[model samples]
Target: MNTKKKSTSRIMLDYLFRFKFYIFLAVLASIPVSIISASPAYIVQKLLDKVLIAGNNNYLLIIVVGLPILFLLKGIFYFIQNYLMAYVGQKLIISIRYDVFSHLQKVSLSFFSKKTTGQLISRMTNDVNMVQAMVKGSMTILNDIISLICLFGYIFYLHWKLTLLVFVVLPFIGGIVRKFSKKIRRVGHDMQEKMADVTSVMHEAISGVQITRAFTMEEHEIERFHNKDRESMKAQLRGVRVQSTVLPVVEFMNTMGLAIVMFYGGQIVINGELTTGQLIGFLAGLGMTFSPIKRLTNINSVIQQSLAAADRIFSLMDEDIEEGEEDKNIEIDDLKGSVEFEDVFFSYDDKYDVIRGLDLKVRPGEIVAFVGPSGGGKSTIVSLIPRFYTPYKGEIRVDGKNINDINIKSLRKHMAIVPQDTILFTGTIKENISYGNPEATDEEIIEAAKMANAHNFISDFRKGYETQVGERGAMLSGGQKQRIAIARALLRNAKILILDEATSALDSESEALVQDALENLMEEKTTFVIAHRLSTIRKADKICVIDDGRIVQLGTHDQLMEKGGEYRQIYNAQFYFLDEASGE
Candidate 1:
């Protein structure tokens, strides 16, 4: 949805400014190269008119020496021009790549949530590569224009009448190219979008290959991929169709001009108004002119492609980040870990509230458990404490100060979360454990791991703490992953800890081990536990049963049992289900 329109000229000018010094050098080098390249036609004209016509053998020696020297100079200038342009192109790519990556870091989580990993990866790789191609390809356009000017000047000097005749067809060519350019730009944008789709599908299929195979959905996935591939192919062919039409039209026009020059110039020569040498020079210059003109016409496509990529890049750069006010002169040396939600209301969308008029307080070092149905907003409440999402209706306070007034960075620094779905990066065991506190020493990492009951199993591995956990800790079992996640949270030693269904994925044995670990970790921290398993929260200092985004019951386990309310209903249901299953 985030997209913008960027002009080709504007994008081209940005690149020009980005590589001004090198472009200037390239242009300067090109001027003399153009002169030297154009010099050959002039030399040939002289050889025909002066040396051969006068029957003079003396000028032969001059031609042999002068021609090679001209060629060598041209070659040297050509080398410098290419090298400088390449250097400029590479630097521009580097700068643009850095800008895109930096912008990505600043973009909010919602931006990523709406975008596919493949689409973003394609932009960073394929789209950026296209921009690079545009930058490097632009050097040819620059050289073509320079050469066209030099050749035109030579042709005009040889015979101004014919030169003028050749240019008479240019306006018509410009009109045709302009019309074709509009079509090219449309197809180019569509093509880029199609490519993004293909990348998205490819990324999804690859990442979920295991799931696909388990469900025997390989054929279905292939069909889906084929559909995307077909769309991309169609878009590419559409682009090619536009290009194919434009080039031949320009070439046909060029052919017509050449025909006119040949017919009229032949009459002039026969009438003895133009000499053979002058006519020959004019034809040679005219031939040289067509290549650059054709090249310039072809550049329309590259310009359009670069403009399309620029639009996507700028759109990402323009995303509005969640605004946070700067906090100054307010520093809490010691956080008591008390959190209070005052009439807090939140929603993914403004029109529909998820957590409305919710007020609660948790004292420091207290273990408060929130038990609820799936969509009761239990996780949402815990998320607010970390400032992941701000409440729209009311305020949340930490240590009696409005959380919005606190530095978000400083507020988050004192809290740690162990999500239901534990995430571990691709790294060694020690590295993932110490991720929450990179400054933690080796002894501290081992201590935290031991506290989570992960040290024994990690020690059993061949590399012990040095064992590399595969991507997302896939090498570890589910319980192992949870244990490492707990170790990570423990290593943070944060004043506030949140366990969001942290033990849900573990087996009974593993859950018991992790429960003991959680009990140990929750000793002094103000902890909020979100759980559906009632047994796990029995020892919680306070248990709040949430239903339909409201706290339906708040009491200790025994008190909630005595109330015979919603908590009792859920507890009885689970307890009966477990009892019946065990009897069977």
Candidate 2:
């Protein structure tokens, strides 16, 4: 890997630097804003000395007119600086959010298995939003630092002796800010994690509402959600308490320094060491520094929060995407549906093997049925065909090429899958049918739907193809959704097909209709079927009875029946209940 992982602060700086031109403009505006902030103190001195003390009434009009202009210029610069900083900050956040979202699309499926949907959502939305505060915090620090320097310089110019007294409070203020920073960063990080827990509970409750109602566990789910919500509230309150106390403590320190300067300056004025106007101007300059000090303290809190958020965002971005995700490897032009598995051993977790020493060879346009008990690695065997998981001990080849040597996208293009649970997005009937082949024409989509035995029921709807299917196709019946999924597979028209208990959830009549559709789809393609219903495999070209991750019997249905082995016993056991019910 050529890429080096970056620290969160460095990553944020890189994003901020992308809009350096805007930052430069804001900096330029802040310079004038800083100078204007100190101008009022100078004006107060001239007004007292020339108009009041010296009785020079002519200078009164100039000072009166110039005070408003100084403040007006400050207003203009402040607006320019704030607006520019905000624009740059918002742009920076957009870039970070985009990177986070784009990175997720390429990560391996295993990454998702180990993570929850709500945790990812919280990082993508809440964490990214929090990082935006970094921009404002940075700009506030920059502006305040410049303003503080100018105000202090004005005070030193007016009276050098008193300016030295201001340094007395500096060390203690520094100690206080440093003391709180680490604790603030820790709590801020903790608060964000608690909020993610709250989000996770909300997501689980919302997504599983159907199951919740069916089980009559509404009260249980509500209590679960409430517990998470209360934890988040406590965390938020802890963060707020820490943040609120910082400003007051720092302000109190600034007030103490101000009080010392006021007492000493009064003594100087009484002793004829300084004029009343010069004293007031020095005090005004000293007073202006308080605002900047208070603002800098607040910026520390903002920075700590942003740091907490950036840490989470970068952690997600750094997750490894799928191996060989780039299509540097190549495969065949015309894929023949031939497949061979040579001593393949696989595992979902590294410790336990799910498919052990499995071997199979399939000719082009052949139907291979895998019939086994639950957890017999039937689904795992088919999943290996599309290269969803790699076998550690063996190889799977398609059309004379090892699947590992083929581009992932190119490898999966010549195949389609109909899972036990049909997954359909929220869209119209036509959209769901054409999901696999979005470029398919309306006529082609209708033809595929008709072949899947879904067109008749779809046409019965008032809006026909345009009828809405709610989230996960909730508005449709189980058989309707399964048919639409089959239609999606039909639209793809791939060379290899896998039916993973497709008709297992349907009623007998619906199963027959879906079975007919499956038969139509099986023509001219190499098919792999993992069926719970033994009758579904009686007409299959070959039936492989698998148990304990090994194929115990492999033969045609008649050949297996004649052998009188595991396949015969499994078929007898399944049909015995059906025969008894029918009074056979």
Candidate 3:
């Protein structure tokens, strides 16, 4: 989906409209609260004129009885208004979170490569929280606005001439709000960025705690986290300074307007142009009006901060998640193991081609190994077969049909990968094995684990298959994790397999057993391997030597050895020490 560069208001409005029915109820609830709020000034005018000055005891009992009933109704409606808006705010927040997370899953891997786990986590929890406050704040503003309208109506009824003068102070208040708004917004945005940095720093330190202890870098890690936290604190303090100044400036403007009303309204009463009760009621209503007007001034700060948060959140929501994501209309129920790359030109950054006009073909049930120097694009070649990345030019065909024309999920369904660094989710051994095929029976899971040589270690534990792997399989050793990964792939029963140093972590005995198991598993499958150990791929039908993004040699291992090139050079580099020790 293309990113939408929507305005702040539009972004908020679009979501609010989704729950407009509830929002309407909340605003409707506020109307009664607003109406009851005007009752105080009217009651004051009546008590002064009828009960005190006119000495009318007949209306005294009615005023006393009516006052309590009016307040009781106000209390009930106020509760309704507050509860409804809070409910709406919470629902809107959940919707925002749902969409953001769902979108993250659909985006390409490149999007995740550029983002840190902490920044994404912070955006999900912290930034979304900030938007939640904005949502509630807007509803509060709306309630205050309705109150202002009611109070001003009563004030104008009491006396229009003086009411016009009160409005003169409005333009000044608005000017002061405008003056501070930009500053507050800038500070708020800076504060959010600093906080995200703090979260990222903490995440890295926590996740890499073992690395820190191994190198005795605990003090350094602690100091790094402290510095990042302090930076966030300073940004928060700057925002507080900006917001704190806004209130007093707005307060000063309100006090000035009230003084004008008091002096002029007092003169009008003395001159017999207005009744004393009417003048007092006008002041009462005007005082009520100023409270909301003052809140309206502070709203500039709330609104600016909200806009800043919305800008950050909406930007992520608007990011273009590249085309050809999972779940396309095209599905492949049957797949031949054959894959061919035709004149592919690729780049991680478009500046230089990583694979310059490369071409390769793999027959069904063949083992193809890629051997090269580090950063020679060996891994990149295997990565392209899964469509993890698309070639800038040319086509990758699976079963002789362009992969771009197939459903990504369906394309991936027939393939399984065992990455160089094994990642096992926090779960039991049985659960991780069944992750490949969730509907697999317990017997099938045990069978796959046995094939990968993981069943023995798993059965040795007191909990057996139920033993926890901890976060990222921290409780398990490297070899154990790798075996489990292999078991998962074996259970998947894919026609196409990718093994990136799948046995690198295993001891010699385990490696021998796992290699045999893999050979049996790879019997009728097309497999791609990025081999660091030259001896591992000796039996591969085709060995390709990749150098600086192009295949420099391609033959059987023995053929490549006899041909004498990059493959032989890499093989010699690995066995050079052993060759010297043996005096070969």
TM-score, each model?
A: 0.91, 0.91, 0.93
Quality of model 2 by C-alpha lDDT: 0.86
Better of 2 and 3 by lDDT: 2
Q: Candidate 1 at 63: error in angstroms?
A: 4.0
Model 3: lowest-lDDT 10 consecutive positions: 319-328
lDDT of 3 by residue, 28-125 (tens): 88788777877788888888988899988887888999889988988998888788778878898898888888888777777887988888888887
Which residue pairs show collisions in model 3? none
Candidate 2: stretches off by over 4 Å: 1-4, 55-59, 271-273, 502-509, 578-584
Model 1 stretches astray by more than 4 angstroms = 1-19, 37-40, 51-59, 325-333, 502-505, 575-584
Name the 10 consecutive residues with the lowest summed lDDT in model 1: 1-10
lDDT of 3: 0.83
Residues 1-584, candidate 1, lDDT per residue (tens digit)?
A: 22235454565477569678888899899888877766766777778777887766778778988889888888999999989988887887777777777878756666787889988887787777777778777778777777778888888888899889998999999999899887887888788889999999999998789899999999999999999999999999999999889889999999999899999999998999788888887888788777777887788787777667766765666775554634333556689999888888888767788898888888998889998788998988898887777788899988998888887677878888899988999999999998989999999999999999999999999999999999888899988998899999999999999988664456789977887787778879998989655555677888988877788899888898898888888878765575466562
Which candidate model has the greater lDDT, 1 or 3? 3
Highest lDDT model number: 2
RMSD of 3: 2.7
Which candidate gets the maximum TM-score versus the true structure? Answer: 3
**CA lDDT of each candidate?**
0.82, 0.86, 0.83
| Predicted structure 1, TM vs. truth | 0.91
